[model samples]
Target: MTHPLRRGAAYAIGGAACFAAMSALVKTVGGDLPNSVVVFFRNAFALLVLLPWIAWSPGKRASFSTRRPGMHLLRATTGLAAMYCFFYALSQMQLASAVLLNYSQPLFLPFIAWAWLGERPPLRIYPAVLIGFVGVILILKPGMGWAGPAGIAGLAAGILAATSMAAIRRMSDTEPAVRIVLWFSVLGTLVSAVPAAMHWQTPSPTQWSALAGLGVIAAGGQLLLTRAYALAPAAHIGALIYTTVLFAALIGWLVWGERPDMLSGVGGLCVIAAALIVVVMRQRGSRTARA
Candidate 1:
């Protein structure tokens, strides 16, 4: 790979690792706090950490300007819902399962683009999507009656997250990425505060440290993801996000003593394969279009 591609890959991997760590921390504090509280603190602290950059840099003003408040609202709402479902499902189910299911978003992205944006995906995208679904089935093992509500919620979270991502792509044409992220943090914090207040459990010092770490880790991850996308095409950087699953599995094993069963392992492999295929096809299609 070229230096730029390599750099992008490294940044993407770093982002994925940070995200995986955040997930593990959240899982560690799963029972001690409500999902709302967790989400609130995560976003709130992230926003706090980002405030220095946002305040000191005059360049960020254009990003906050509103030529598209409606789009921002839609994106933020979808993002909020996605996070809510994700945190809830993660709290209720195994970490590996929730992470695997949520990572299926890329497989659904092509169809969502075709339907919502009127842009047809390449033929290979369909088979890749089917393969990803098979992977999900493997993880869930529904025929053996192992699937549960947490799995269903995770799927819902994936769909919502996919939708939000699609909207983010569209919004990126008009709005800055930082603006979208800032709005998401702002809206997420506000929306989560209500429910968090209702189920408020004061965090111990250790839990507070974990929550703070969650915020810092998530903020760093988002920055790295943004940097990666800026340096390379989405197809190149996006597929690398699958590394989060492996990271999640490893962290879960080391920290929580949670291990995926044989089915989940097989399913995770399939999902990774499908994601790689999608990335390859997208790159080829882009090259062909340029040629």
Candidate 2:
């Protein structure tokens, strides 16, 4: 691989690792806390971490002013909803399965973009979408016990995440990464606080530490992913993002003895392949337009 691609891959895989670890932490402590509480800490503590950096840099601090408050709120609301579903899925399902379902966000991105932005996708993407859904079906097959509430929650997370991503794309031309992340953290904390307060439960000291670490780790993952896209086109290195699934599977096996069945394993492969195809096709179309 070229140097840029290599660096992008490293950042992407590192981000994936951070996310996998964060999800593992959530699964570990999620039983003791409400999903709202978990979501609150995830956003609140992340904002805390970001606050210091903003304070340190005048330029970064100035970025707090945005003309598109509505867009930011939309992103935050959708992202927070996605987080709630994802956290609930993590608490109720096997680690790898929950992570895989969440990572399926890319599959829905094209359709979301088309509907929201009027950016129609290429015709070839239809087959890729079909393949991805086949994988979803296999992974959520009736016998797998994953077709229940938790499965629906996991799937909802992916769709909501796609919507959040589309909002991000709409703002990408005018919003820097720091500003986007900051607003999301701020709004996410405030919005989630309501439900968190309603379902409030005091956490033990150890749990507090875990929750703090969860937020910090998540911020680090976001930074790594942002840098990855900066270094290379999403198509060239986007496939590496799926490493989160592998890392999650490893954590699941080691910590919980969770091994995927043959069908689910195949399903995961299909999903990964379909997502890759979608990414590559989009990249090529963008290049053709430029040419």
Candidate 3:
């Protein structure tokens, strides 16, 4: 790889690792901590982390004052909902299953783009979408007791996250990354506060450290991810983002002795393959257009 591509790969893979670690931490909090409680700290502390950069960074500080407040608010609302579902899924299911389920976000992007931006997807996307859902069915195994409610939450998380992420892509056309990330933190923290307060559980000292660490880790992942995309075109490094799932599985096994059965493992591979098809095709089209 060329220097920039190599740098982008490092940033992207490292970002994915951070995300994997953050998700593992979320799972560690376990059922004792409500999703709302964790979501609140994830947002609140992320906001604290972003404030300094926005206040001081030469380029980003100016982007703080945005003209498109409504778009930012909408992304925040959708992202906040996505975060809760994902956290709930992580709490309820095997770490690998939850992460794999959420990976289906890419399957929804084509349809979202068509509706939101009038960007018609290539015909190939249709088949990829079907393949993706079949993978979901395999992973979900709806009739199985293990994949019941948690499976549903995981799917919902993927769809909701896809919506928010597509909107973020559109918004990024006009908005700065700092602005978008900052607003997500702001709205997520504010929106989740009441519910978290209502379902409050006092953490033990160790759990408190974990909760604080969650915020820092989550924010760090967001920063690295944002910078990665800024440094290189998504087409060049997008597939690398799936490293998070691999990293998560490693963490799940080492930290919690969690392992997916054969069926679930097959399903996860299917989802990853289908999502890769979509990404690879899209990147090809982008290159074609540029050429």
Give each model's whole-structure lDDT.
0.82, 0.89, 0.83
At residue 81, what lDDT does model 3 achieve? 84
TM-scores for candidates 1 onward, in order: 0.93, 0.95, 0.94
Scored by Cα lDDT, where does model 2 land?
Answer: 0.89
The weakest ten consecutive residues by lDDT in model 1 span 54-63
Taking the tens digit of each residue's C-alpha lDDT, what string does model 3 give over 1-291? 878878888988988898898898888895788888898988887788777766675675336578888888888888888888888889988888899898789888888878998867789877877888888888888667558777888888888888898888787778877677777777788899999999999888888888888888888877787788877878656688999999999999998899888888888888988898888887787688889
Angstrom error of the Cα, residue 177, model 3: value is 1.4
Clash totals for all candidate models: 0, 0, 0
lDDT of 1 at 6: 88
Model 3 regions lying over 4 Å from their true place: 59-63, 287-291
Tens-digit lDDT track of model 1 for 40-149: 99999988887676566558552666788888888888888888788777887778789888877777777787798876789877788788889988888886866688
Clashes of 2: 0
Residue pairs of candidate 1 with colliding backbone atoms:
none
- For candidate 1, the TM-score is 0.93
Whose lDDT is higher: candidate 2's or candidate 3's? 2
